[model samples]
Target: DAGVTQSPTHLIKTRGQQVTLRCSPKSGHDTVSWYQQALGQGPQFIFQYYEEEERQRGNFPDRFSGHQFPNYSSELNVNALLLGDSALYLCASSVTGGELFFGEGSRLTVL
Candidate 1:
């Protein structure tokens, strides 16, 4: 069975640009969460999506946005990207208030 999966396993972007990352949740999951992990640091919660609505968010700036589809897949969009945005973007899926299953993550590099 397929677990969580992310796209563009690795990507590059420049400061002031924009980028979009995608994720597909594991089967039977209805909640999707996003996180950003800097080198040597634990992942920072970015946001969570459920039933096509954003249910929660973290301390990230307004530049970060996300969408959840009825199919339980999601997309993370970062506008006017900054060098500080460089990090591993992780996607996790689970039933609301249940155990989270994480993906390998998509590594984003900003220059």
Candidate 2:
């Protein structure tokens, strides 16, 4: 039984570029959610996916999007990235009540 895991652990990009982060859900879990956590701030939900469809979404711009696979893994894509986009991108998994179990996150640094 594996918990959620993220790749690259860290990433670097420039303003106006694009970035993608990956996530694998916990075993036996079928829901995935993406969150953005700025330094010294709490995580803000981006979206949630279940059964390969988006079940819920947050107040994010069109530049933020995501995909969930049949295996329950997910990817978060951000376009035309900005320096303000520099934050910890977290992937969380849950069953019900939305009590999220988070991963270590993919840290993005916009230069």
**Best lDDT goes to which candidate?**
1
Please name the candidate that would achieve the greatest TM-score relative to the true structure.
1
Alpha-carbon local distance difference test for all models? 0.97, 0.92
lDDT of 2: 0.92
Candidate 1 colliding pairs: none
Q: Show the colliding residue pairs in model 2.
A: none
* Cα lDDT of model 1 by residue, 1-111, tens digit: 999999989999999999999999999999999999999999999999999999999999999999998899999999999999999999999999999999999999999
Which segments of model 1 are wrong by more than 4 Å?
Answer: none
Clashing residue pair totals per candidate (backbone < 3 A): 0, 0
Q: Which ten residues in a row have the lowest lDDT in candidate 1?
A: 8-17
Q: Kindly list the per-residue Cα lDDT of model 2 for residues 1-111, writing each as its tens digit.
A: 889999869989999999989999888888999999999999999999998998899989989999999888999999999999999999999885567899999999999
